[model samples]
Target: MDPEGARIQDDPDVKVMMAGSTLRKVKSRSWKKQRHFRLLEDGLTIWYKSRWAGRGHSTFSVTEVEAVREGHQSEVLLSIAEEFPADLCFTLVFHGRQGNLDLVADSPEEAQAWIRGVRKLIHKAQTMDEKERLDQWVWDWFQKADKNKDGKMNFKEVKKLLKMMNVDMNEEHALHLFTMADKSESDSLEIEQFVYFYKMLTQRDEVWKVFQDYSGDGEKLMLEELENFLRIEQHEGEQSGQHAKELIDRYEPSETAVKQGAMSLDGFQMYLCSQEGSIFNPEHQNLYQDMSQPLSHYFISSSHNTYLLEDQLRGQSSLEAYIQALKRGCRCVEVDCWDGSDGEPVVYHGHTLTSKILFKDVVSTVKEYAFKTSDFPVILSLENHCGVEQQTVMAQHLSQILGDTLLTTLLDGQVPQQLPSPQELKGKILLKAKKIGGLEQCLDETLTDEVSDDEEMADGDPESPCTEDPPAANKKHKKSKLSRELSDLVVYCKSVHFHGFEHARSHAKCYEMSSFSESKAKKLAKEAGTDFVQYNTRQMSRIYPSGLRTDSSNYNPQDMWNVGCQIVALNFQTAGLEMDLNDGLFRQNGCCGFVLKPEFMRDATSQFSPEKPEGHQGYKPLRLSIQVISGQQLPKVNQKEGSIVDPLVRVEIYGVPQDQAKEETSHINNNGFNPVWNETLNFVIHAPGLALVRFLVEDYDKASRNDFIGQFTLPFTCIQAGYRHIHLLSKDGTIIPPSSLFVNISISELTSGS
Candidate 1:
């Protein structure tokens, strides 16, 4: 059944949206103006305009919308709350780093209509199957290509549409296909004809060759043939026959093919595109990892400068950044608190031009969103620069807003030998800050201690750590005064300065944690890698970007995780390869922000060193073979009208120093629509347990650096060994669906020395 047809009648809000209304698009307090808004008949897009007669209008797809916020939930809407009723406002939040759309309706009924309607459409988009998604994508292209709005396209328009879709086809061949689809004896074609033309153009010859190799007949695969394919190609062992029957039943679109227990070309393609055919193992998609282990046994997803949306020196500090981080399953968030002019502490980068947000509001936002994505504990790493009085106010806000979720005392009412598991601290927030006394002394009211803020400002010094003696002119020193009110909240995760590995191994408590700058952490991982791994067994460690990174760029978190560091913090506001790796590593195990470290890394006396991996126990190497087959619907890197991407695939492995390697396929010229490269890349990984495989696609260039098109990353343990589809993601980590690489992967164990 079509979901749209099934739900349209029961949805009155959707009906109201289709009827259209006049709304005030609010950018700022003074920039509110009337605009006409209407949902198109297709129900997949919305368009708004200040005047209906001109081309001065904008349109957005319902798929772009992530969620709808009612009332004055956004900063822009809050700025005009006094002028408008709360019920008359709403905001449309988009995926990735796109800005939110704030608007005001003439009536509360209109506001509710748009809000509920967009929410319903978003749900529909999310629930769409692969086949439905493809059809919708084709219709969207049709809409874009029909520039004259005549619902029909000439050959000229069709040619332009092909370029827009990242296709550089031969003109003579395109005209022939165009004539084949135009059965009306006319030079133009409609939407149905356009879809047919697309199907003919994108028929995968590579898939057809593979299909022919297995099928006795060229047209379909019989049950016995499919079982053979699964056994020989997919290495499914004894269950190959059962799995083949299931695939045919689920993916075969034709009723005759389903009854015959055979797979046609279409069904085979569908099976290859399904989750069962993806490179990532389906078993790892949910909460499959053990979560009952101590908190230090897993890698925690963390963000630094969580309140800033941009750079540290000058950026906007808003509650939205915290909300965004929490929504992405960030388990730890850092807040740098300074004294506000109004007595309440403010959160922002100190001595910078960045805007300030009240510390109370930041706590409130965290309280609301912390458990929305994952129920695991959230670590609030406070960089407290506030004085004693304002520190008390900050503590009050946390206790009041977070309330029961704020863990004010020990879990068992006694000091613990090891930190509690995520299961034991579900829905709880732990403070990671300096404390005045031990965990058992939190009940004392008058206890206070002074601690040097050296670790806090360690990276602020501009000199290199290798310098023997830096000049005194570059030195910056300070001490933070810990207040009892705030210290009481620090039950676990007490921030402390590192006094060297021998000292920590002898004296450090399990609940204590230390922060390290990226440069310092990198140095430790390189020089004392084994010691770092063993130290993280009992206590957690956080690795943060250096303060000299004023632009808020991030270092690779893989190196820190190589040493078993739990809290590897990065600037969540920045988007790059570092953030991509972070997103990919945490995308598994229910995306709960805690990935259990390898068993060797979790043992107390483990001798694992990323620099020298052969010394570790339970070390086994494996050979990885990947066949780069083809790409479908890859987006063009350049937006020029006639440009199409000359795409290539680069397979990269990130693990220990010995396992890091990359290999690329030759570039396919002027063909991003359906490029084929029947080439295989081989890799021998020394530390397979800790390795992450990244599949990157780039538009090859001779005169400059290769432009990144899309990529996907997954842990080596989670890779499915078979013919699979690797769906691609854009630079900002948004899914560019129907855009994927079809590949085959095989893994085998390596013998003694070879």
Candidate 2:
């Protein structure tokens, strides 16, 4: 061992080592005596070990050696040379605590031999059938590189093929490949070039030598020869059918068979027990866990059947039964309420409550159950299917009983009076007012009577039984009197505190009142001191107020809410409102929540549930809205002398900027009236931002184009910002209508400076 090499190895992490005769004295005498043997070699240094001597074994062993440079005095080959006289005197081994154990090389011959061994190992690692599928897949890819059914590949072909494979190659770089292995540009590639190209395509350098060895005369391979070579290589293992079967057997699907088909609940449970990973997929598992955990409140539509609570309630019609159902995990209960002649709130679907359970009982039971379980709170939603006056009384009764815990009161056309006893319940009572008129009447009516006497009886009439004033002819108008009384009652109600209102109406009612006067309703509401005027989304544009009087036709929630209306209940049946739910616009822009029919809520929840609940039943409520924007009759373009041209006309609808254009398009197509050639076309419509619209003929041929003569703008008047759909028609019928286009129009508020 070289003394200098030993010192350098001892402090491997150290930077430098100085060599001198003092270092040489530290070496064993055996190393010094082997000077002649060391001189034959170069850069020799030695080190000696004194401890840990075995019986009759030399205590000192060769630790490290340095070979002196042939020409330079300072330059030397530094290495740890362990003696293994039986094999090689100089052995390279990885350093270990038990002296070097992992021998890298026994001699110079062994070092060269290791390189050869590594090459073979790499080749075996990349062998067919043993290597990763990607390695073989790359090779197969090159065999199919020639596209366009071409028999041979040129530079352009190669570039195009590489591009098809998503290879990044610029034109200049691609052109440079022509001479990559050709050695000369003859406009044709030789076998070497083709082989080199194949190698480059496959990204396998190990196979290059095999291809070069097989290339005869280093010229281009014929198409037939190339195909034959590929086929031969692909079937090399298959040549022996036994070996092919063995390969197939090794990669066959697992021995355990997997059953397929729809799984029963029991089967699903068993499968879950058997699976090591999550029973549901990881994504669904997380969602299930999130849903299974205790929620602040669990909202369920009356029709939901996931749990047995509803069934249990259905089994027994008593409030105690309902309470028991809740103990079984019913967090919220929905009761449809109708006015009872007894002037008390009742739970029933319509005018009669002969069979259905009473609303008062339901509320009382729910309250008791909630009080019993401090952790499990019970919330009640009264779906009012009664007159507006009945809804008011029910709201009063609910405010007295449930207080702030009443989740929602779905009234058709009523706004509840604010209860002072339960201050927290102020916002909890949601009055689903169906239309502007109902809310307006509720807010402004003062129950005042106006009487006019048509004629006065003579003093002598009726045996002079009358006092100083004589009675006049009596003519009773029931509806007028009722309306007047309702108006007066509204005034009386407004004198007290009223929380807020919601609009819950069928799609048909919303469409029918689409043309209702929002401004007048808003004025009436303001006079009555109501918080907000809520309406179905079908009336968004009509009910929303305007910033400017000129564009007052466009009713906007922003304008209404800005004018002291704290909340604006949005009907969710319209597609525009549904999109708002997804975009978070409802939460971001308004303080109001949504009012959906029990059935609508159920449908939406069921559609989005992670797992389909068992025993699901469908529920229906006529709250879906369908409105038409415009339609036009096609004139006779081909007829000479009043010959009607049956040109197909397409109608296009545009929605307010903030409204979703796609939904508006669907609404127009579904609701637009089918037009006849000579008759006038009419449609009741609801859309957002219905701005400029036009109709046109598909083919502009001279004979057929005559029918499309005119285009029509919507509303026939300026509309306010927000969603507005109006009745529009093209009278002339000459302009060919467009197949329906829904445009989302967004108008930003003007900045102070801009």
Candidate 3:
């Protein structure tokens, strides 16, 4: 049955944009058929139906969408509409997807409508407040199920709510939820209890599944199985097994303590959330070593266009954008500060219709949210467009809102030769902007009430028209000046326009930072690999995407990181494979947004190209053998009655070499809960230092694309070597323990000259 057609009558969360006469084209095949495409209302997904007999229903998430439209070909496509062209199409590229979606349109109007609607909807979905959206969703479910206008829901009403959400909840599970939600045992649920019930329901399901998977006799797991679980899943060898035993013994003080092998579900939730919720193992402190190096010695998590909540041209610039980025452990955020209608300056995208937010509001939001997740210093990269007087207001707002947290003096108060470490500037906010002049000179020139007063600022609305004074009679506009208030705040992180690498080297001051366009950085990386790596060790370097790539897309961060760049800024609003790689790399050392540069890159003496470098030692190939034991208890995707999901375990090895990377896996079957593949896989690794292993559980579908069940990635060096229980994790990075893959891994180096 078509989910789109099945739910269209309900007019639920998903809205239909165009469903009657649109075409759908799958990427992997050459066939193009007439189909009905449904652009969803919430912008999270799009559903498609083939008008032809053989095709069925399919859905694609917006996060998977990489690009839309093709070279403004709508006009050309429309002009040739009368020709009845079979090849008339638009390409939709997706991340990691096998093929590009070649969407065909019968008419030019249909093509234009589909393209515009999808792009616009995607923008709105990305920009909305996540928590508020969830609240709205819960409220909508409550309103739909309460048929008799009662303030609360009965057991039947609760089941109806599940049906409305398209959740496949069995009767026993439904009863379990009602009992948990009905704390007073009244058999009724109010709105508050409904939300809490939903939250606890998922947690209970996860914990229960894990407990059921390991408990062989439908009771607690035996000691042998518990030890195997700790060795494999937790990646802890003998030490972790002992710790697990202690934990189980402490949490579950059962009368059968010595006789029993495992604990019950009562202690399972605490273990998953507490022990498995961390990034690094306690024994592996080597990964967090060398924090004493200057802050520039680390790769920082950064964001570009931090103010725009959606599209670069028309999205609303909000304080919420700052909050979202900071909460996600971003250390550097961009602010485009321009003159506002009022005396204060505003932050927004200049030369565009994007909405404006007050400078003070952005600062206050930053002050409140900054250091909440990580105590590292934040770099407020200000793209200044404000005049002298307005600039002062912006500076004053930063100082007042941030208070002593605003860094106005150098850490050492001297002409420092080395950059300050993250430890030195804890809780400090550094303003990064173009330096106008010396602080003393700027101090004497300030206090100007109105330097021409901007000839009247534009209205704050995004739709407002621009009005400007005539150019200074062709005598060339005088150079804009920065007062002491603003310039002094930029003592460190003074942004400098990059001309060339050699010119950047002339200034040895670590405080003077250089910004590079993505193209320039890539070009320099390719051209001067050795020289660029050396420069990054001493001075701070920042790389941002090229302006021409204006959809807020990202460059391959690995390209810049290979050259030791500290801040390779990415668009936080967009999600794709680039974001995945970024998350995987930083999922080490406690996720503090500072990853210590690799040894070769940091050494300044030994030049290392991230690729194969000549004259490097310890350069040996690795032989890794992995055994796929069995999946304990894998959960079904979407919780449907009959899942078409044939589960398979894919072991992927990602190295620097483009071709050397490989993925091997066991056979696909539906018995994931108790799958016993006993499959042994082996690989020859070319770059262990620059490699990471990703374990993925995917559902194989013969008719369409495979669905992702869950996955976890870690550096090749950090993994504990042994027969360990590999714990699985959801796409959101939360641990789902006891639902594990038991595997034995043997990593050894092949002798050279063999």
252-326 per-residue lDDT for model 1 (tens digits): 999899899999999999889888889988889899998999999999999988998998777898899999999
Tens digits of per-residue lDDT, candidate 2, 551-652, equal 112233322322222123221111121112211221111111211211211221222110111112431111112122222222233323223222333444
Highest lDDT: give the candidate number: 1
TM-score of each: 0.95, 0.21, 0.62
Per-residue lDDT for 492 in model 2? 9
**Residue 388's lDDT in candidate 3:** 82
Off by over 4 Å in 3: 1-254, 259-287, 437-480, 618-643, 649-655, 658-660, 664-690, 701-708, 723-743
**Positional deviation of residue 469's Cα in model 1 after best superposition, in angstroms:** 22
In the range 259-288, model 3's lDDT, one tens digit per residue, is 465766655544443323233344442346
Candidate 2 worst ten-residue window by lDDT: 68-77
**Runs of candidate 1 exceeding 4 Å displacement:** 1-12, 52-54, 440-479, 752-754
TM-score of 2: 0.21
Worst 10 residues of 3 by lDDT: 455-464
